[model samples]
Target chain A: MTAVLDRAAPAPTPLRRDRRRWVWGLAAVGLVGWALVASGLFSGPVLNPAGSGQFGRFAAAALRPELDPGFLRVLADSALVTVAYAVLGAGLAVVGGALGALAVARTTWGRRRTGWLVARGVVAVPRGLHEAVWGLLLVNVLGLDPWVGVLAIAIPFAAVTATVFAGILDEVPRAAYTALLAAGAGRTTAALYGLLPLATGRLLSYAFYRLECAVRSAVVLGLIGAGGLGYQLALSFASLRWEQVWTTVYALAALCLLADLGGRTVRHRVAEPRPGAGRDRVLSGAVLAVVALTAWAGWYLALSPATLWSVRAREQLDYVLSAAWPPSTEGPLLREVLGAAVDTVLMSVLAIAFATAGAVALAGVAACPHRAGPARRAVGGVVRAVLLLLRAVPPPVWALVLLFVMLPGILPGALALGVYTLGVLGRLVGEAVEEADRRPRETLLAAGATSAGAWLYGTAPALVGPVLALAAYRWEVAVRDAVLVGLLGAGGIGVVLSAATSSFDWPAVTTVLTAIVALSLCIDLLADRARAALR
Target chain B: MAVGERVAVVGASGAGKSTLLGVLDGTVPPTAGHVEVHGTDPAGLRGRALRRLRARTGTVRQHLDLPGPLRVVHNVNAGRLGSWSAARAAWSLLAPQGTAEVRAALDRVGLADRVHERTDRLSGGQRQRVAVARLLVQRPELVLADEPASALDPALADVVLELLGSLAVAGGGALVAALHDPALALRHCDRVVGLEHGRVVLDAPAASLGVTALEGFYGVSR
Candidate 1:
């Protein structure tokens, strides 16, 4: 019976055979789409050689870790700001997610499926959208209040958290719920007694996951003038202070890693159920204390509810509303916007393809830590660390850094996105390789086949399907990041969007926002279909 | 064969017992034959017709093809996939369909409580039982077993074979299984058709065929 499950399930043979052909066909279409856009990508020389001196300085600065005392103090302070934003942002996401989850609960609307779908969809709107875009949008209405930074992070985080919370709620045992119902208990009492206890642990762990994401997003918010290490980094980047930029980057990296380590620790502790009541109590206390401190810091920023309704804020919002009404479709500007969007799509496609290809080589070593000598394993470790740094620094930061070496254009954006995407794709491909069946590999090894040859014959076939699916998923993400990559330094529709937003060109900004949302949805749908097909 | 007839097709490797079963299951068209199954020509069925015919005739292959990732209940429920509307079937995955009916089917195979458990986590014999449970849920007029117990231990294999036999007889349906071992054919089956090189070499009641008399069916035709 192993043969039936090994190669095929009960799915008919024709469907099985046709699916393989369909995958290849989709891949070909993707390539042709990329080619069409790529062919029209260039007009003039893509890069200027004038920045070679700055590039050299930047290369030299990488050899020296940032250690100046005054600069170190600034980094430390900014680091605190970034963490506070993340903590407060995550706290806000939790509150918002809880409220949103209530709206999404099926029992709330009863048989009104459309209401549930609408609630779920409204929650999903912020997901996959760039936090920088949120920052820009909020800043337009709210000015530079601390709420802009917090809300930008909170909105999307809440949207995703709500969906996950609902999933956890759905999985909670219904026995207590049924019992409560039989006793004529209200939905509120039953949910509180039955669902909350079951869901809190998983939701807390997931909130920790969101915290790590929030930290990264807050850093991205810096590009749109929301204060943090990202703001400082962008400043240092603008003045060609390579060493200072690297120092700020190192601090940001430290903050991200710390958040990740702490989140993992908390999640691990939360997951341990047996013989850990005292420890769980202590951990929960610590979490609450930290949250209180973060809320205090967030409050200390002097943002008041009164400021939200301030005459100036209201006037600015009114001005923006009047200005942005009715998106512009001027013939010349419309063509230019479309061209830039096409460029953005092409760059993202190129980025994913390059990242997937390079990641394969990186994954080969990473998947097998016992690959030959200790020297080779050490090299693999070093490579893995570098890739971690690449992804952890975030794409916009990479774009800013790469701006010195290459001209501001689609090419630089593609390179930046590709480098960042490599880290993600490498991890995915490595996991796929590790999970694949090893019997054929063993047989080949026993027959004196070379390790690489054994992998080629055995592991490659299994890796191909999953890797393709993951690469497509990553491409969707890359496209989202590509928007901000241009806004940061490299040129894309983000540059146009940024300019439009700055001059309060509401119509043009609306046009750009619409284009991005449309593109994002289209790519998301296409990738979803492809991933489903692969499954 | 009559509606309640029980038959066994015995063969060595490369014999066409599986091919014949496939043709009877409406999955494979015969090169040239009457190909009669359940008062209809299975080879001539198409689309909805083919699916409807196959729904009343459950076939278990050597590989015991229950989806490993799904719960035992879902695998069991998949037996009625042919009868379910696409939306109903899809929605059933979110929450199980006909839970009581599925549990009843599982009870017959001695795995009524493992319905919610992932099929992959089960032992090999248990997975085979889950597959049998699927056939039980199907309620097919004909039970076709294609070396279904080839992968099981001897004791477990006997349990599976006996369950298939008893279930078919209890449900008043015919049972036809392809067997590799002639001894198993003699023990569990009432009548045997010994196939060699895609043709029947011997046909008789199990009570009449002795151990020595099964040698011709076991010999390699190649």
Candidate 2:
């Protein structure tokens, strides 16, 4: 191989492997092994055999969930609370993101690279931490106020939405904007007319996508003691009420399905806007519905601006700021933070690897091919529904439940995150599969290739690029979610942060938070590099 | 058409040239007439029997439906999927099998240097040649091509036609092509069949017809 490279020859070689992909593949395998070893899989037993009974109870409960009328009423109320938080949070994020996009957009920065870099850095801080972490921190300042849930979801989601929005803005054809400028329009006026019109469809599409995500985030926030379905779930789970837990899971899954269906419809409508119409009725109806929902959510949550600036809120904020100004650099804490960060990265790697593998395997069946036989379509529908349920249940819930069967270690957390990530990645990969060109597969089939062989030679190749891209995107997400599962002593920096926060160790908490932000930033950069290499 | 004969099917855009090719390849069945290839009625064949028959009949479709993200070697090797076991076919994607064979096929098509390049990165003409290279490796007893040289220059088109014709001759099989170029068709084929509105209006030896006769089939006065 070295000799071939030294020659730098363009001559036809005997099927030389892609060296870059080989290196990446080897590195991934090595990292997975190292992570497994670090997780102590080989050193001792990881499974808790005695807990099998408990696991069985949880599994059995799925077949017969709690159906008490009073319990059902509580669940319905909690579901409303969850929806309120999600609507308000996503709505707030969109408003904030739209404004922040202007600040971060390349058109606004122009040639000022440093200014753009700094603005990006500022957004990264908020985006780095998971929503649950924001919930924990907000609870300290806001106490039991409803603002805790909304702010927790909005803060991080706003940062993410802003980054995506800015990218969308930058990708629009700049020719229109520059022409507007050349025609004597002011920069603001020019961007408003030229860029905004071009990006509106994509931006609105993305906002709806965020709303679906916000629904999930709000549930995770509830697990951390904010008021929602997850709060009820957490309570039932603590009492070993398996039936109630199953009930909550079902409700959450139904809610997720609703959001998914709604978001998909709006995204499709936005992508293919009705031609020569005054306005699409579906689009108009969707927008109007969202506005009405947001208003109702605000009223239902009893959100008040005065609560944000109340005296107690100010005093707690000042105290926390003062205590957290000089972050702890104690030797043991720093060492612990470093160790936990490594565990976090490894857990995320294992999770992503597992998710990617599962997603790829399921993508073919999960995608409902238009011309498929009835049985295949039925299988696809079931697979898609299973995926929805997998993602509907939060990672923390998965971690806790999985711990019942498996011993408390990194494996359970990794698997929990893996399953959740698979739910998300599978749908994404399936969509890619659905959208793939069908001609190649048909061509191969016509050439007498077996169905499986044809797919391998044709459909699979087209999907490799997209599947990897989606996996890379999901890997970054899995890292943030590792914290959620880790909060239950699953393994990662989240454990450390939870400990610090419980002890009211503000300085230590601040240090761990910073470390998390820094770790996420590094992973984001690494994932970007990996994606570019794959491309 | 006799074994080892080369036939060119020519007509206007919607003269059902593609549909005829499709029927020959067993994708579209003939509605009114009976058809047989390699002494077997493809419409009645099922499973392994159908696949075995199909493996002997190779086609270069008009769309050149090759997976673009795959390496050129893999795309060329795809021609062997019908004969190879599924496991071998899959493993070949990771570690290509019969490289020398693939290389030789590509070399004949003047694309040997692009053996490791992604198929999508190639130009339209190069991709067409790659498609031709795929059929070369398949070693089908019956060859089918539709506008195989549509993207190529006159010289390259001639070269491709010669390769397809020679491959058919080597296997003692007939070559059937739907061509647009009257001169190329008249030069390379032994027989010419002209169709308009799905009806065969003209069928004669290529040697008996001039380019002007074929051009007339295309509604071209010049």
DockQ of each: 0.02, 0.51
lDDT of 1 by residue, A1-535 (tens): 2322233222211211345547766775777466445634555555658877777888788778668999888877777777778888888898899888788877677799999888876766687567788888888788778889888888878887887888788778889888887898888898888778878889888988898888888888875578779888878877878888888877776787787678878888779864833456656775887778676766666557787788988898888888887999998778878988888888888788779889987887777543368787787777777776777777877776677666666777888889989977887787787777764444323222334544543356456668878988998888889998877657777888888878878999888888887888788888877777665
Q: Give candidate 2's TM-score.
A: 0.96
For model 2, the docking class works out as: medium
Native contact fraction, candidates in order: 0.00, 0.60
The true-versus-predicted C-alpha distance at residue A262 of model 1, in Å, is 1.9
Model 2 Cα lDDT, one tens digit per residue, B1-222:
699999999999988889998999887879988789999899889998898899898999899999888999999999998898899998998788999999888878888789999999899999999999999999998899999999998878988999899999999999999999999999999999998888898999999999887777797322
Evaluated with lDDT, which candidate comes out highest? Answer: 2
Worst 10 residues of 1 chain A by lDDT: A8-17
Give per-residue lDDT, candidate 2, residue A468. Answer: 83
**Deviation of model 1 at A189, angstroms:** 2.8
